[model samples]
Target: MEEDFVLMKGNEALAEAAIRAGADGYFGYPITPQSEVMEYLTAAKPWERTGMVVLQAESEVSAINMLYGGAGAGKRVMTSSSSPGISLMQEGISYIAGAELPVVVANVVRGGPGLGTIQPSQSDYFQATKGGGHGDYHLLVLAPSSVQEMADFMPLAFDLAFKYRNPVMILSDGAIGQMMEKVKFQPQRPRMKDEELPGWATTGKTPDRERNIITSLDLDPYRQERFNRKLIEKYQKMKEEEVRFETFQCEDAEYLFVAYGTSSRICQKSVQLAREKGIKAGLFRPITLFPFPEKQVGALADQVKGMLSVEMSAGQMVEDVRLATNGKVPVEHYGRMGGVIPTPDEIVEVLIQKFIGG
Candidate 1:
């Protein structure tokens, strides 16, 4: 039997879930709509009861560096912030990825080119999945569309981060961060018994071995290439195994709408409206943005002649939609930005025009 669920905001759930997941440390600076996350944890029992270290760092830069230190110590850890804070942490995130450290960071993204807005937006799509900071690397970007999924995916983020020895990101938005919904919570999982963490973790060594080192710096070019190859292999495995998505009314529909994060909530409503209007419309929502649900999108393209992308931005994910549709199906985009969420009615109107125009 499972415990009864409760309604909670996505950011609160994330904080609670991270606590329940046995995360040993959390370091972050405040930024809205994500500020509630740090607040929840800071005021909660995780620190007093579980010996977890939760700190509000002076800035995002310091917060992420603290995460690096915790990860190097072989402890489960997490950090949370909005776009501007995330931008500051990008340098640290890239460093964590290069060091092959298992760390989790949650970005409750607000609109931005530079402090564009404090409201929700999916404008960070490319930034989150395309190695936002620098170099040839990718963070496993998980986009949670609901409050339940927000809570549910926090532990999954940590598990995957540790499993691959790579950084993982929960790419959310202000709406999801602030919305309330019923969600069942599960007991924390026990630490893995079969596998001890890598020896490179900065755990103090026994007399039998020498001090271990963990870093991204490799002076030898050949050695650097080898390291890069190993990272690539891990990413490939994730691409094969970790891609995730949800489909609604996609089967037998003539048109498909693709969205993620908070945008999908509106898209879900659009699907309902489209159906009521007798338009054969459906939705494909990507939960994992990096190892994207391209296969599913491609399959849908074979059936649907037209596809439209709904995002909070003018068009970032539209590119991915085009790639998925292979230039065969005509893809369109509709959005609002600087904090305005695209309403379902708006999306439905777009679909009606595109589908009925022909």
Candidate 2:
């Protein structure tokens, strides 16, 4: 049993977790800091043991379309990429959302506007949570702050994907993706059988049943409006049922640091450092970013003097934090962008300077 635990980089753990989660297929293109996900999958060769198919598509565009096809057939499928790669997949992701197909995706994010450096970042918060592509839609986004979560989130994301019949994204960063940590493998799950496929799957049509034609196209304005409304209802359901977050030492704190993914890990350390300085500080980590944990942060506002949103980008998440706090308290934005990671001490001092003051 102990042998099931091993040290792995975040990307490697995510790859192993997918196979153990009974994923039917993975279609991905190589991208820095995230390519290891596909590399590990191909090397493990789960096809023999679990019958999972692993394919390397020629481009991010190709990979996402392959994911669309696999998912439309009711297969538990996934793909992963970094920032620019994810940007390329936007159109297809929107299409899958419109069709209401379930699939998991991991964005091991790096710094980016375009062709950004292969370094850790959390700049894609807006894109991931607020719909990167076209039209009205949302992808349930999970932010993993550690390698263990990189492994743990695969099955969770898959389950939520199927439950909502919408795309689920593991919004990771290069720091987490490349860093090594111990991961205990999940118990292996059996792949879904043909009999277990969902009713809406576009498998071969039987004579006794109506054909399942999966598509995102709706030329009629009235029908397109209906489709949009249905998607809104689904997003509302997710907001009600799927909001996930964590609070540390917030039970009795005067200041709060709200961050996610790699930034959350840094803020956790800052919390400890601030405590040593006689400042009552706590860390609020958002595990599910899409729902944005609005009510939770709003509730926390009454107890804290101020909140600082720390991120690996130029304060992208700060806007959400401000919206969540609802002007009850001052919510300041502090971050290091373009592949730079903020240190624990740096965050502590910034908190004091930003909200505490000399």
Best by TM-score: 2
TM-score of 2: 0.99
Give stretches of model 1 more than 4 Å off: 1-3, 190-198
What TM-score would candidate 1 get against the native? 0.95
Per-residue lDDT over 1-358 for candidate 1, one digit per residue giving the tens place of the 0 to 100 score? 3447877889999998998887888999999999999889988967676777899899999999999998997888899999999999999999999998999999998988898888898888898998988777999999999888888998999989988889999999999999998887768654432147567678787798999888878989999999999989988999899999989888878888899988888888999998898888888999899988888898888899799999999798999889988888899998898899888998998887876773
Estimate TM-scores for all models.
Answer: 0.95, 0.99
Q: Name the 10 consecutive residues with the lowest summed lDDT in model 1.
A: 189-198
Model 2 clash pairs are none
User: After superposition, which runs of candidate 2 have C-alpha atoms over 4 Å from their true positions?
Assistant: none
lDDT of 1: 0.88
- lDDT for 173 in candidate 2 is 92
